[model samples]
Target: MTVWILVTAALGAALSWLSCRFLVLPLLRRRGVMDRPSERSSHEVPVVRGGGLAVLSGFLPAAVLGMLGYGLASGEYGLRSLVTFDAPGFSVLAMGIAFGFIGLVDDLDSLSASTRLLAQVGVGIIFAAGVMLLLGVGFFAGAVIAVSVVYVVNAVNFMDGLNTLITGWTLVCALWFTLLGALTGSGSIAIAAVALALAAAAFLPFNTNPAQAFLGDVGSYAIGGATVALAWMSWAFGMPVVAVLAPFVVPAYDVLRTLIVRMYLGENIFQAHKSHLYQRMHQAGLSHETVARIHAGAALVCILASVPAVLTQGWAGELVAVSIWLLVLVFYSYGPRFVKEHRAKEHGSSSNNAGGRA
Candidate 1:
């Protein structure tokens, strides 16, 4: 089963990479589907957007193949049995496509924030209700899941400002989920995570500094929806909540802090702005690659720390996870100020040295 999953992932990665480099990129350029430079944008030139179509092209087929493989391996080949074999993973793929469609419309026609939010929430509710029905959870749990889906989808979109920031971070989290699933003997989680990782990996090359194409809202929304779905699936598999949530810690903190600061300063929270911690770090003189690598590194550290904690599974595990979370949060929160202060000190010392020479 593991071997089959690996083969599927490899094929998906190849297909995703080829489609992005050939079909998607050419179509976007031909159609002039470009993201132009703006005050809130990190890039200086227009780049082709909507590259997520390639990701979908790769991921959807792979997911279907994976589900079929799982069903056959389990000797449950009926349509109903296949759908129920891994309800959460199937739901993830379904909701991801729905969200991707919404993003595609927004990319082309530019939907208003209210409309987009409404659409997202509506889809989220359907997803939550489906999961609740399949898993036999309560209405309260379903409501919480719905809210979480909305939050995660938007948070991911918010964090997608920098080159390779969201893409790289997502790849890391997917890899972590894949490992967790393997460790826990959840083939569904492992297969789904592998497909997601491959899709992100295929997209990474184009998304690097001097990006040739952007994921646009389509990729971000699909990735976000898929991420939350996997987290829910992990929870259902009896993984510790902290472990399941570990991958989200960095992005969640950044998004929440940015929103709070914007609201406190009386800025329109819905307006586009380069106020995210990662964006500020770049504006503070760090290169886009530097800032992106930093975020990816932080996410990796948090995920790595979660392993032992998850395995331990108790107050001790919770303590480790919470402590790591707080530590990273403090670092990210104060990072910009620290950079500014250091630069100021350097300038002051240089001025004094010039005076002495004079």
Candidate 2:
């Protein structure tokens, strides 16, 4: 079964690659749509940036295949709740599409931040409503779902600077979910996890920094929506919040910490600036590609650290979460030193404060 799953992923990845090469990129380029590099951006050259459209080529078919396989195996007319398309599941898919469409338009026309945020709120409301429509669920669940959807959308977008930061973190989260599913023999969960894992893997090549393509709005928005949806479903299945959190704790904390600091410093948190710790590294003369790989590697370590939490139950999982979380706090405190050193070198003859505003 594992072998078959791997093979399926490989095929999906290959097809996805081709779709990016022939379909999405050509269309985007031919239409003269591309993100031009500027003084504020990292890339020195103009590269086609919306290649995230390729992810759908991988995500949709794999998810459908997972659904079909599960349904056939179960001999049921209704879709399997695990990986198949059902009411809430289809609603999740619709919200992703809506988010991606808004992002695609933003990439094309450079929409204002407020404009994008409004669209995001619309998508979030749809997602929250779907989750709230449970058999006996109530207003508390609806409130949680609404707040969570909005937070996930913005938080995930915050981590998307540099090359494959968001992509790498997403892959780590998906792989953790898949492993947990396999360990517990939850076929539906495993199927959903594997589908996401394959989609993220397929996106890796293009997303690596000096990224041949940026996730732009489409990639981050859709992936973030799907991730939050996954978390909501997982929590609904009686999993603890820690299990829902273990996969995202690092990226989530980074965003939250950054936001707190930015607010304290009187910065417009909504403004696009290279103040992110990772963005600082890129400004400190590190190549975009190097920064991407470093984030990816860090996410990989986080995934490894999550194994025990993913496999453990109850307080055991909480223990692992607490331990890894403290480590992230340390990283946040000292992580800027690496960037500061490089900044100091570039401006040896002048006084510059790159720590707060790179």
Candidate 3:
């Protein structure tokens, strides 16, 4: 069964790569939906954007395949069982695809913030309602979940600026969820985890630093929605909130600090700026890969540290996760300053050396 899952994942990745390389990217380029470099941009050249549609191509089919396989093995109608209320599973899958469409629409026209927020809220409510109806949760719990979904979706969208940052970070989170699923004996969670991991893997090649393509709004929104959905599933399946949220702690901290700082500076929080900690590292002469690696490494740390919590579901686990989260906040606040100063000193040293030689 594991081998089949692995094969399915590999196939999904391959299909995603092919779809992006041959279909989505080419179409976007032909339509001139490229990301041009600007004062607030990270890349130097225009790249075909909206490559995240390829991830959808990979993830959605694999998820359907997983559903079918599970259903047929049990002598049930494959897709029929999935869409029914026996499980809240279909809602997870559908919400991801729905948000992707919303994002694609916005990418095409750059919708107003209020419009996008309303759309996200509506989707969140629908997802919460589905979960509540399927799992028999009360309205209060459902409302909380709905609010969390909105927060995560927007958080992910905000952190999608750098190449391979969100893509790779999301992959790490998905894999952690897969591990958690395996440990907890939750097949649905594991299936979702693998699908997302493989899809992100397929998208990573084109989206790395010096990327050939960007995720655009479509990729970011879809990835965000799917991730939050997966985390919610993990929590619903009995993992502690700390364990479920640990994978995202780094990104959450970074984004929160950025927002607070922006507000403190009297800047419009909605306005675009190259002031993120990761962006600062990029401006300090770190390559895109370096900055992305830094963030990814932080994500990996959070995942590893949170593992015990997922496994034990105890105060110890929660404490460790929270501690790591606090540390990540400190890093997010000061890491960029350290990198910037180091880069400045390095530049000064190089100048002094050149002067001495000349």
Candidate 4:
């Protein structure tokens, strides 16, 4: 069974890579679905966006098949296993795909912020209502979870100013969630995570610094929707909320900080701005790769923090995890200041070198 899952994951990654390299990129480039550089952009040149569709190409079929396979072997779905349309995994995948389509439309037509928010709200409510019906969650709790889903999706889209940041961050979270699923014996989640993780890995080479392509809104929407859906389901089923949220600490903190700062300054929160912590670091002369690695490392710390909390199931373990999160939040909040200092030092050294040569 494990071998089958592994094979499915490998196949998904391979297909995703091939699709992006040969199919999606070409089609997008030909159609001029490219992202142009602007004051808000990190890149100086345009690159093909909407490359995230490759993820669905690679993940959707593999995930559906894996779910079916698991259902058959475990007799979890009886004969209906072959047609998994009613399964939770299928529901999540379908919703993600739908959101990705909406993202693609935005990529082409550029939806207004209010319009996008309305769409997100509608989707969130429907998703939450579905969860209440299917998972037996109560109305109030489900509504809260729905709001979280909206936040996660937009948070991902907002923080996606740098090459490889969103893909890398999502990859880390997916892998962590995969591990958690395996530990909890939740086969559906484990399989879904495998598909997501590998798909992101396949997309990374093209998305890294000096990127050949970007995920655009399409990819971020899909990734964000799928991630929150899976985590919400896992939490509702049995997993602790802490374990589910641990991997997202960095992005969550960044989003919250961005919102608060914007509100305090009387700036509209929906406006496009490169004021994110990672963006500040990039503008301060940090390379895209450097910022990505830093964020990935921070994500790793959060993942590690989750392990003890999951293992101990005690207040002490949870407290320690929370403490680490708070500490990291403080560091991230002051990250811009450090970047400015580093940039100043670099500029000074360069000036001294030029003067010495003169």
TM-score of 2: 0.84
TM-score per candidate, chains pooled: 0.93, 0.84, 0.93, 0.93
lDDT of 2 by residue, 1-358 (tens): 4643564466557766788768887887788777787644766777786776777667656655654565456653245443334523344455557777887888788898788878877777767766676536787877777777778877777777667677777777766665655555444455555666677677778776556677777878777887777667666555566667765666677678778899999998767676777777666677666766666665555555555655665677677767876776576546568677757777863545555465
| Colliding residue pairs in candidate 1 | none
**Model 2: CA > 4 A from native:** 1-4, 76-92, 183-188, 301-306, 339-358
| Model 1, span 48-139: residue lDDT tens | 88988888877777867885687567763535744564445576687779899999999888999899999999998988887797679999
Provide the global lDDT of candidate 2 against the true structure. 0.67
Model 4 clash pairs are none
Better of 2 and 3 by lDDT: 3
lDDT of each: 0.84, 0.67, 0.79, 0.82
lDDT of 4 at 153: 93
Candidate 3: worst 10 consecutive residues by lDDT?
A: 83-92
For candidate 1, what is the TM-score?
0.93
> What is the per-residue lDDT of model 4 for residues 1-358, given as tens digits with 9 covering 90 to 100?
4654686588779878999999999999999999999878998988998999898788887777787788778866544633544555666686678678879889999998788888888888988888888777688987897799889998888878888888898888888777776777767777777888888889999998789999999999988889888787667666776788887789988988878998999998766788888898888878888888888888888778777778887778788888888887788777778989978998999999999999
* Candidate 3 local lDDT, 53-117, one digit each (tens): 99888888886677567546655345565767243345557777988998899878889999999
Arrange candidates by lDDT, descending: 1, 4, 3, 2
